[model samples]
Target: MAFRVREFELALMHRMQDLNAGKVEEALHGMSASRAELRAAHAHWTRLAHAPRAPKGAAALRMALGAPPYRGSRPAGSLTCDVLRWPLPSWPGLAFEALLGPGGEVWNQWFVRPEGPMTVAFTDLTPWACVVGDLGASFPGAVQIEGPAPHHWTVDFPHDGRTYRARFVYGLIQRLE
Candidate 1:
């Protein structure tokens, strides 16, 4: 999953470069990717959206609770993708959207969803709650710094009679204990 997302980062970087070069036509107008490619991209993105950030960006988000800060190629930017129409309401339209930020890291990150992020409270998801990735449950605990963590942050939950811990940096999850 990380490998695929890492590759998607490259695709996003190149697209950003083209957009920055004022080549809107090149960025906006391009041959669509294959069905397999689209699935791979989505799989990669989903993992990144809930991973941990790096050391420098000093920005961290709880992967479980919501998407990170980067939805597209860059912060506050958007990306277009050619997705299959068979899955009803899986994403949005041919072009779903979310928000993205650099967070100073690469692999460990998260992004908003088709709509975007929202103000949330951590207390509601911790203590004795269950967070299962299989069911698409996110437990991005509360922000310890009251904002993006300079180094990292964490949230704990009770699942399967065990106390599970998730760490975050740059709005990504590094590990789960």
Candidate 2:
């Protein structure tokens, strides 16, 4: 039951909305992945949706942000508000990031390949960045960082084969150079 990380996230999202959704079934019938793989992921998502709650919006957000991405998911990395160490994800390092607000609401969330090709969100962005779904790498790639003079940086996407640097502020791309 082999499947890509993207597929698992999509299935999990669908299953979260409706446990009985046939989206996974469609994937199986279309041979997108093995029936076993889809079924296992779907089951895991069920447990997440049905997991116990803290009963308050803020508490729930805090709980969810603290909880693992999913059952048995490995630790990825820690959040970096300003100048902090954000060690790259090991190997095919893919991590889901969640930004919380002062009121304990989810301000933003995205998937990051700390050492892979940069997504559009990693470049040419301004205030109120759009939320990007979880993304992963099929093969390991490289990403270079410049500086955060005042909590800003330049992420080089060499894989894109461009001669520009992607500037980031608070993990959101401010512009490209």
Candidate 3:
């Protein structure tokens, strides 16, 4: 079967379920999907991701999500890297981004707010409402810490003279600590 964007989103939810099963379940319901569907999507995604014959990097992404709506270049330390972005149905305001190295290897893949000035305040830090980049932009002083597991991240930011830690799975905010 051909992998598609919906399967990509479901695969994302599969990783996110570790942090917020309830929210993932609700999303599955909203998509008119079931746990079995989620599992299958994830399995399919895994196969495509690791298959030796499968397209890699941008080609793979295009195969799954079609041509990206946005493509550009960004600095990656001493090297410049290519960036590709696609909008997802689940998050209208955010975009899924993949950063690729010079050799066309994917360096990172995550959700990011499209270019614009974001005025996110502490009160806006709700679960599943924001991405890691949003907090870094809104809270300039935010410090990133290693997450408890892979595909997870934690950021500590100051608000009202106190610090708060935001936990994320697959770069999407999961909870506030």
In model 1, the worst 10-residue window by lDDT is 82-91
Tell me the TM-score of each prediction against the true structure.
Answer: 0.24, 0.28, 0.93
The C-alpha lDDT values of all candidates are: 0.33, 0.39, 0.88
**RMSD of every prediction:** 16.1, 13.1, 1.5
28, model 1: CA deviation in Å? 26
- Colliding pairs, model 3: none
Best by lDDT: 3
* Ranking 2 against 3 by TM-score, winner: 3
Give the worst 10-residue stretch by lDDT in candidate 3.
110-119
Tens-digit lDDT track for model 2 on 1-177? 333344445444343223223433554555565656655765654555466852343233333334444322222365332111122121124455444544445444444444433444333233213111111121124354655453344545443454445554334333445
Cα lDDT tens digits for candidate 3, 1-177: 568989889999999998889999999999999899899999998888799998887898899999998999999799999999999998788898899999999988888888743668888988789889889889879999988987889999998899999999878899898
Better of 1 and 2 by TM-score: 2
lDDT of 1 by residue, 26-140 (tens): 3223334343454565455455656675312212222221233323343233633221111112112211122223333333232223332333234433211212221124333
In order of listing, the candidates' clash counts read 23, 0, 0
Give model 3 RMSD, 1 decimal: 1.5
